[model samples]
Target: MFTKKILIDLDGVLNEYGKDKFNENYIPEIKIGAYEFIEKLSKQAELYLFTSRNLMLATKWLINNNLDKFFKDVTNTKLSSYLYIDDRCICFKGDYCNLFDEIEEFKPWYRK
Candidate 1:
């Protein structure tokens, strides 16, 4: 089975965007179960971080949250990656509700 490369967004997905941006110099607490969900995905596929957040902020967040090790690479606006995971994303498939279902059943998981 082939595993798809995953590109995850940091803000608004992994971490909440509720707090003041300036106050969030730190990792800003993660969303519920975000870390667990990513960790699960990381085991089966090549994980990459693709975010518009500043390098310093993004790096600090990853380090503090213990997520840096899960990612193969971290990319900002200057880079490109396949299969972006973001809060503000449009589904390629007509049925948006099945997005997670699709990802969960992607390869090895589906074969199982």
Candidate 2:
């Protein structure tokens, strides 16, 4: 397999998230299609679950969900990657003028 690094967020991305913010010892539910999504992506890229939470907790969750095999690592740092699949992000196509509006209107899918 080619080296295509893809960093994915955990709490609100792979896992089903609620309004509660990311915290330790509180593992959110696994989002629907998460394992399938990971399975497909694993074929095309080196996936690293990027989260702000503790690695041990995340690891346990991943293992329970049968997702640990698909990911190369769980990271807090953003390493070099071809793409970042995150739930909390706004695509900026170089339109700097509309950035403020986008930010203000930005609500993660989990929030909605």
Per-model TM-score on C-alpha atoms: 0.67, 0.91
Among all windows of 10 consecutive residues in model 1, the one with the lowest summed lDDT is 103-112
lDDT per residue (tens digit) for residues 1-112 in model 2: 4689999998788876775675678888888898898999899899999988889999899999999999999999989889988888897798699999989999988566
User: lDDT: which candidate is best?
Assistant: 2
Checking candidate 1 for backbone clashes, the offending pairs are none
- Backbone clash pairs for candidate 2 read 16-31
lDDT of each: 0.72, 0.87
| lDDT score for candidate 2 against the true structure | 0.87
- Residue 4, model 1: lDDT of 72
TM-score of 1: 0.67
Query: Which window of ten consecutive residues has the lowest lDDT sum in model 2?
Result: 15-24
Model 1, 1-112: lDDT tens per residue? 7767878877677876545454545556777798899899999888888777677788878888888888887787534445777765555766678888777655421123
What C-alpha lDDT does candidate 1 achieve relative to the native structure?
Answer: 0.72
Question: Per-residue error at 55 for model 1, in Å?
Answer: 1.3
